[model samples]
Target: MSTFRLAARVLGLAALVALLAACATGPRITTEADPEADFSRYRSFAFYSPLAIESRGYSSASSERMKAAARAEMEARGYVFTTEKPDLWLNINAYTQQRTDVTSMPTVDYAYYYSYRARGYYVVPYWRDRTDVHRYTEGTLNVDLIDASRNRLVWEGIAVGRVGRSGDAAERGARIDGAMADIFAQYPYRAGMVPAPR
Candidate 1:
């Protein structure tokens, strides 16, 4: 594989990890992560993931599949799904900035002039990298695990990364799963939960 392709895959994995690990402060946590809490209390839920995920190497169909995978993974972790009869509602939103967001305007660059012996005229050749800023969109995905019974946000996790212009169905699923897993890494919904002793 080409270096760039390899880089993309490696970077893709790294982005997934980074996004999952990057957490945003969510609503205050009221329950303890210990065995004392009853997850059944806030069981049924609904969550919206990117309907646009499947369209690059990722197509729209892929997005639907990605959502399914995310839902499935969450379900395996004990959360039940329900739209009309949900105790908790999940809302997923994303914010992205194109590579251009970090780019500057083009500037004139000097070039060495080479003279042609026959014409005695010098010409300077200049060109820019067609893909000067071969870009990616840096974005944040926010997952709100809200409590419908209370009508307030209960848990929130924001995953952040620079998503390349190209993502396949596989990549999308990997990212979604990786991100959600990271969010739930702090599960049981404890307030100010810290990692246990090393």
Candidate 2:
């Protein structure tokens, strides 16, 4: 292959690898739990709808997806979902912010100037400053586990990452699922834990 063509192919491969890495990236997760609380005592959970409303305007579909993911994870840890008086209440809150980054880059180029005395083209090297603007949206999701009777937060998990605005419903759902899984992986309590097979 020609040298130029080979260089182009290498650049293309690098760009493709970067894109895949970004797509596979998951949200950063942080979790905290009350050390005094008895996690083993919690047996049932119910969604705290009022807290969801207090957070802000969130789509029902998205809320349902998050709740469902949480529900599945809780069940795996030996928790039951109940509408009646429950041992724990689950609440989710999400918000997004717009971020803008501006960077100045130095650029070097050659300029051609006409000189009557030289009777030839003169090349001049000059440096210019170029500004790059990057705009993106960052989103954060907080999952809180509250003691129903005490009305106190027992545990909280948060995940933050860059939010993709243009994706199909299925893609968005998958992202939500993945984020929830990551958040739940931080849960401090596990019922009947077993070692994984190699």
Candidate 3:
């Protein structure tokens, strides 16, 4: 890969790690649900047979952790986990992309001048404008709830944040769990009950 692309990938990986590891103060989360769809009618949940995050006919480790996280959240909400027919089916997706940030600011620059009278060098300071370009990775996690019978989306949660470059599988899994919890906390409905106004 090109140097730029490689740097972006590294930054992206870092951002993904940060996105999962730093939940309370890092990721920004948003959620939306189908206004017309009744949440109370849903009592059971299942993951899509082939999750959106899957590739080459297999599931990724991150996808498996995401599934486990979602299952916990759903079950806590009184939704049963089932592979068979379910009232709701969830599609989970995670991805990272390179982002560029450009900033400009006024900076102080220094220069030295030779002074014959003083027989020494004098320091002169001036104001200079500078611009900096920064490259980093942005990670996103999306959870979509679909009506199995109608095969239509009913609710969705999205999280976006800078991913840091650190963590092992266990740590990543914990972070994924944190991210999932943050997403589900936005879910306003319980099984067989309408969402209360927030």
**Candidate 2 residue lDDT tens string, 10-82:** 5577568759967866789999987666776788999897756356645577788888888998898888889
Candidate 1 structure quality by residue, lDDT tens digits, 32-99: 23333234566567753323342233345434543565567567666777777687666655557775
Each candidate structure's TM-score, on Cα atoms with residue i matched to residue i, is: 0.48, 0.72, 0.79
The model with the greatest lDDT is: 3
List the candidate 3 regions with Cα displacement exceeding 4 Å: 1-25, 114-123
Compared with the true structure, what per-residue lDDT tens digits does model 3 show for residues 63-91?
Answer: 88898899999999999888889999999
Model 2 vs truth, CA RMSD:
5.8
Which of candidates 1 and 3 reaches a greater TM-score? Answer: 3
Error of 2 at 35 (Å): 2.6
Model 2: lowest-lDDT 10 consecutive positions:
189-198
- By lDDT rank, best first, the candidates go 3, 2, 1
The residue ranges of model 2 lying beyond 4 angstroms of the native Cα positions read 1-24, 53-59, 112-126, 191-198
